[model samples]
Target chain A: MKQLRHFFDLVARTLFVLSSTPFRMKEFSRQLYFVANGSLPIVLFCVGFAAIVTILEASFHMKLVIQNDSMVPGFAALLILRELGPVVTALLLTSRVGAGFTAEVGLMKTTEQIDALRMLGIDPVQYLVVPRLIATIVGTFLLALLASMTCLLGAMFVTDIHLGYSPAMFLSSMRVFVDFQDLLLAGLKGAVFGAVIPLVSCHFGFLCEEGAEGVGKATTQSVVVSSVSIIVLDFILSYVFSYV
Target chain B: MIEYRGLVKRFGAKTILNGLNLRIEEGEIVFVLGTSGTGKSVLLKNTVGLFRPDAGEIWIQGREVSKLSEHDYLEVRKVCGMVFQHPALFDSMTVYENVAFGLRRFEELSESEIADRVKESLARVHLKGIEDKKPPQISYGMQKRVSLARTVALNPRILLFDEPTTGLDPVTTRAVNHLIFELSRKMKTTSIVVSHDMECALEIADRIVLLDKGSIVTQGTPSEIKKSEIPLVRGFLEEVLA
Candidate 1:
């Protein structure tokens, strides 16, 4: 019951911060730079590998069932757009950006900086949480799009070399099966995961105990909780988006 | 002016401030002296509405602080500033940005004007020409001074200090204490410093209020407190002054 109350409180506060505009625009841009720009290499690398693995597995299964490689692109596209792209990107970000947020805010809490903000008549929620939340939401959405594209390119490269299909053939096959709804589901998953990552990370960070050990603990907990949350939320979102 | 009437605060099962009552007059420097865990810091935090009291009334400058909403508390907080023990300068920002933080958030000033104010506040704390330096790059003493500059730039009516001189060498401690004295005298801001440093209390405080176990053990001018015969007060004074 207490956990539920805190969760509701966080949701309410997040909604309030989202509705209020013109809030710390400079901080928002800085966070966007950190979250989106800083995580690009890792996001690309992770999604690319994930795509290769998915394509290998799907192509092997398709060869056994239909005795051909034609279904590789369609199967790979469906997997990437509906599951691998958004989930992998969010999990990577959960480790990178989400843990970073926890450490930063947790350190601030330990060092009395949060109290300093309040003493300066600045609401810490408005100053700290809002910008990060907005940045994560927007950054993760774009990164998910990037992830989908990278995965497709990776699959195409693998199939062109190994499966005896040209890049154009792979592209056309994917385009035939991968519709706008798949892209929308991926984008929606990214948005929800983005929101969940920061909310959990910041909550743990704000509730961090004192000292260096406390910060370490909060950072670890943030990554673990956010990763678990992303996986669970992915399941629920995929179920919900199945009807669409 | 500030007044705490029967302020009560607790952390979990531990009671920190137990119906503590105290009053601080405007433009006067008051030092709250207490050993560790005696709630001196908690008392200062309560005045700034950082920690709300369980059952009490906190009035600052004729306004009741306990009843104020978060928005209303910000209005009250604008008239007050706190320098924490560890300086608490924003780690990501340079000294100039740290000092300018409050001014940017609370005041409407041109960029040049904000720069001027930041420079002037740093100069007031004798920290001129180090605006580009981050908190970790500076000495601990300079960080504390920067913290002071950051708070003083707001031109608050009341200033609160929590263990302001802790962890400093004797020289830096004296310098910080003297800075507190000078700033209070020059700005005529109501200052409440919580410290275990009896020498600092004697040097800078117009009045000393000593707390022991969540209650005021004694409250008087330095000389009066010096003459107090209460065993706990005398023993504490001896231990701190020795």
Candidate 2:
């Protein structure tokens, strides 16, 4: 309980420090660009290709085994919207933005900058971690939305060409099964994933020791921990959402 | 004023400060001189409640400080500003922000008031300009002065310096010594400086305390300490002043 109280104090201090400083829009925008904008191409590519592959396999299996193609569009959309979209986006971000945060903070720790903040009466968590957390949630929210839309469109294209289904028919079928709740679930999951990655990455950074070797160890630990945690969280959240 | 009575600090089996007793008056610039690993830094940290003694009492300005809660410790810390061995400036912040960090946090000053205090503190350390520069962009001596500026910005009643001139060249060391003397007098702040350099200690101390093996071997005016006949004191004086 004493440890929990200290953690709460640290979180409160972080919030206060961020509020005291004027928001640096330029810096935040640059980070947002890296976290959201720069990852767009990779997110689109992975999500789009997943759609194509899922449609092809589902159509083939249904025709051969069950003699039905009625649920192909709904199945693909549900899988993409609820599972693949959120998980893939989070995995890419965990590797890219999460690793960068850990490295930057780890270097600062090695240089005694965090100690400097403490001596100067500034809580390091407040000055460094809180702003990054806010930016992470915001960036991840937008990226998940974009990835979901692009995946659905790509699946529609695949159905039109391969299945001889008209674009109008594919669109109408998607509209029938896709609800706003699935999109909300994916965005919420992305935001949660974004929040967790940095928290774990920074925990590693804060525990960093001295010298270059320590930084290498910390960076490696951050990547492994963040990636595994994301996968596990996605599974749990997906299970809960499916049951509900 | 500060007093430590029968202070005992031990790290497992290692004794750092053993049965130490000392007192400081207001506006006195006392130099604590000792060899390396003699617990000078630990002693200084104990004054601000950073390190609690194993069995002792620390009284600062008529208040028992070692047992204060965190909130009260914050208040006690505000009454003292510390200049670490190295200038511990915030790397991401400019010089002005570094100096203004404490003032903004501990006081309810407006932006302009905080700005004025920063300028005044910088001027006190002869760092009038260069507020826009980062700490690393400055010379080692200037970095020390910026640390002083940051320390003095709070206008604390006590200023604790932990090995203020350990790694500087002779010229920079001399400059820092002069600043220490001048600022303590001008601000009338009780300054507790820890150093292994006997020359620096002799140059600025109103009273000199020598510690050996976690206890005060002897203490006197600089002249008195210099003339002491105790073998340990004489040996240390010989080696450090050599």
- Return the clash pairs for model 2, or none: A14-A126
Q: Which candidate leads the pack in TM-score?
A: 1
lDDT of each: 0.88, 0.83
Off by over 4 Å in 2: A1-76, A100-125, A151-179, A214-216, B6-20, B33-38, B50-55, B107-113, B210-220, B224-239
Question: Which structure among the candidates has the greatest DockQ?
Answer: 1
Q: What is the DockQ of each candidate?
A: 0.74, 0.28
Interface RMSD of the candidates, in order: 0.9, 2.7
| Per-residue C-alpha lDDT of model 1 across residues A142-166, encoded as one tens digit per residue | 9998999999999899999888789
Task: Compose the digit string of candidate 1's lDDT tens values, residues B1-242.
Answer: 79999999999889999999998988999998877999998888888788888889999988888977777888888888899988999998999999999999899999999999999999999887799999999999999999999999999889899998888999999989999999988998999998888877876689999898999989999888889998867876798667
In order, the candidates keep a fraction of the true contacts of 0.75, 0.25
Count of clashing residue pairs in every prediction: 0, 1
